[model samples]
Target chain A: MMTDLPLDQVRTLLAVVDEGTFDAAAAALHVTPSAISQRVKALEQRTGRVLLLRTKPVRPTESGEVLVRLARQVARLEHDAQAELGLSGEGEPTRVSVAVNADSLATWFLQVLTRVPEEFRLCFELRREDEDHTAALLREGTVMAAVTSSPDPVPGCSVRSLGRMRYLAVAAPKFAARHLGGPVARTLTEVPVVVFDRRDDFQDGFVRGLTRGRAGASALRHYVPTSEGFVEAVAAGLGWGLVPEPQADPLLGDGRLVGIAPGRRVDVPLYWQQWKLDSPALVQVAETVTATAAEALRP
Target chain B: MMTDLPLDQVRTLLAVVDEGTFDAAAAALHVTPSAISQRVKALEQRTGRVLLLRTKPVRPTESGEVLVRLARQVARLEHDAQAELGLSGEGEPTRVSVAVNADSLATWFLQVLTRVPEEFRLCFELRREDEDHTAALLREGTVMAAVTSSPDPVPGCSVRSLGRMRYLAVAAPKFAARHLGGPVARTLTEVPVVVFDRRDDFQDGFVRGLTRGRAGASALRHYVPTSEGFVEAVAAGLGWGLVPEPQADPLLGDGRLVGIAPGRRVDVPLYWQQWKLDSPALVQVAETVTATAAEALRP
Candidate 1:
């Protein structure tokens, strides 16, 4: 079993992955290409596993991901330590990397950022991904924290329920009159619909629930990948979709959109998952995010 | 010399890449694991190149990307042909894949979709990527068309200028008063700024231009990722940034945001590139996108 990895070798591996090639990594690190190759080779030999594929832009092997994650965590901890010791230069900001779903980012997540005190001096590196996939970034250590649909904590991390984000099925008023003339279950299965992406099954899941699992949303779907654009597309009569309550309420109130399925709503429970690290910036962000979610999301 | 590739083998390679494993590909294709293995081996033998990395979730080699692009393009052409022959099932929408930048998607691109006549019966697969990178998707055949910043066409694709997207450096009225108390160039380098993501050097590039390459944007940057969120972040006094003209207009009209750098703007020239195909759906989309862009974008 591996007990510890050499810091130089581990950091070299990360550099190669980030820079995409040994020569590039060497240039970035101000070392010779041969030195980068030697360090990577030594790391592979020490771990007894091939850590990288020698592609044009090197790709990390599954085993490499584990070590890469470790390198990032170590780097983060070192930054925290330097800041605490006052060794980090004055006014050097701490970057807090977090993955958040697009809807949350467009709505309440930005509110959390506004609430963070200026004294924290935190620079956010926000990665926008789907709620279902955000946890994968956290698991891969690409991010220190994530807003995810899953409540289960990643190994070595802690999870807390943020609250449920409610989605209401809606459409333009004219679109409802034209296409949704019959029973919602049957009409919805034939009319055009809007979806976030190919991988997004939220609208289909909503349709499936209404149809007793007999059908899904129409094949004539408009893929509007952004959360704001998705809402606008539905409002423009391109198709119907399950819009987040916050985005939907304004359009619904203004007579631009109408709730197609009254009293039926899909509530996706979101969770905050983060590495159990005692970094001050991370702690402060977690508190602000949790507090904001309490007010913004359904309990 | 390589003359032709067997369609079955090419499709099998695509399935394996998409499904991430031989076993999963086998299940998806309704074939045995052995059959999947044999087909992949046969393709490799015929091509005389290793196509896959054999990782847990399989990854394609550089040569494999070439074949994957070919497979996707072939699939697209086949779909188009089927539709032309009226052999596609009734009400089957022709799927058109195109990549667009988030800013364009958030602003004018949705209008292009709204203009498409319902008689065409098209299903759009919109991939949201940065303008700088959208051409890669077109080259990979992951998308049939793209809104890109590149004037040069991807191989086998044609390009047209879509006009320029102007960005204005702006900030919340209070943020400006607090931070921009000195010369514009000097203060911008020290104050907080908002950016789209880590890869976004637009704000930095803007500052560099202003400072005659003396500096870039401050290290105290907040990455908001989305075009809309970045604007909101700036308006909320999180940081100042270059806001796209359409998004900035309303805020600037109201007392919420003020143009910090007056009479100075960064105009990114946009282009529409598409595969040189004869598909009616693709043709119609290109025409609509180009026309809409002509009106919305700066000449």
Candidate 2:
């Protein structure tokens, strides 16, 4: 059934989705608007499913996402084949897209890029998302690889454990004296808190774990989205938060930030997930990432 | 005509868009799916425009974005009014959503949070976006305020200058000695370069400004999405890039990075743009952001 899907029609569907409008897609493909419309209609008839929502900027349906993922994967394979055959233009580097979490990117992930061999001649397109959501990017075919917190692989993707990233509940010494002098768990539920983003529930999860699920972090919270900024916000006494060990270590040593929870820590196990393709670039990245994570993250 | 638009219907449209489906919206609002559908249909009929695309995860149309922004602004005003009248529940802090660029958030924006008076009792929902695209969040009603590079205001929003953020072309001393030995402009077009993200054209724009638009930064580029990571990558000899003055200053003072282009700097004038509502919380944040930018940015 998959073999029956027309490649040109599938490619056209991807182009329309990428360009957002039929007219825009026509301009991009150097085809007439009528031709673009006919191709899309033919593809829809072939699949017996409506693929795109014909809005100002067209959006894909769930069925459409499946095809889009296929189209991207096919394109990636074609690019790899071209590079291997020396058919790609001279000096045109192969681009590898990956979705990574803020913490890893800020800490050990950048080191991966520095470690890649110069012979690879690869250009990296990184999409920074929360660790919990990076797998979604992989499922959507928006990226070829991801550093995700989930151990389970997205369908058609293989996963490997990248070890755990430990976080400490920390606050400035002055903040501890001012607001957190009481029981640590009880005080955390009332004092101001710092979070990575609205989607971040780490601090709340920490508080809930400490208080037997009776409470969460404070209602008065500051959202500092960047990993570096989150650590800085906590150290500057804006609010208490769970800071990753590598980022928190320097501040802890300098007495700029102190551990509020004496022995409690959260360890988030990360995994490297990638499409089950045999592309050399993806293979190289996966190897470098796994090697780096082994050294940077706790076993 | 504007007053004729039903508030419930507008709010329903926002709910459907946020929840991404009629059933989800129904569950979120504690209403039946039929009621959610009827309300959304009514909104479209009243507005004489399709407000949503009925995809698996629904998307708002361009006209829908305008109404969503309106709904968010109205919600903001009502929250402020309730807080002022002391009708808000005990300890329910006002949440102010603001969109800001990464560089500002990392360098000086966190300071704004620390400076806000404790009595404001605010919970911040920050969306970190590129400065060039931050105003789009305002237009989509995703944020009440934004620190944007555009001086031109989004409709229904007022704008104020936040001064200029100057950037310096910097690379590690070792990177400079290796890849950047030739004339700065010509060499920059070919060397490995670092960028904040795909949307980031600052480095290329700097190169174009120097070379009279004949060239862009480099074909071989590494994307380090975080502002701190970007600077760190440059310092780690990954690539040359334009680093914000506040971030670059310390690195330069410490000799970790050297300026590649002497006397050539890019000054991006940032602006504070927010809805023209009389919300005290928004007003306070705007004032603090402006004050901090004044001290942290170049005139």
Using DockQ as the measure, the top candidate is 1
lDDT of 1: 0.89
Residue A65 error, candidate 1, Å: 3.6
Q: Give the alpha carbon lDDT tens digit for every residue of B1-299 in model 1.
A: 43478989999999998889999999999999999999999999999999998987987786887787778878878988887788889777888888998899888998989898877888888989986567667665778899888788888799999999999999999999999988999899989999998789999999999999999989999988898888889999988999889999999999899999988999999999998887778889989998999998899
TM-score of chain A of each: 0.95, 0.96
Q: What are the runs in model 1 whose C-alpha is more than 4 Å off? A: A1-9, A24-56, A59-63, A131-133, B1-78, B131-133
DockQ of each: 0.75, 0.67
- Give the alpha carbon lDDT tens digit for every residue of B71-137 in model 2: 8888878878888888988678888888888888888888888788978987787778876567667
- lDDT tens digits, residue span A1-299, model 2: 87999988888888988888999989999999999999889989999999998876997776787787888889989988998898998557878888998898888898888889978888888878876567556766778888888888887799999999999999999999999878898998999999988788889999999999999998989887888888888898988999889999999999999999998999999999899998889999999999999999999
Best by TM-score: 1
lDDT of 2 at B205: 93
Clashing pairs in model 1?
A: none
DockQ score for candidate 1: 0.75
Could you tell me the lDDT of residue A118 within candidate 1? 82
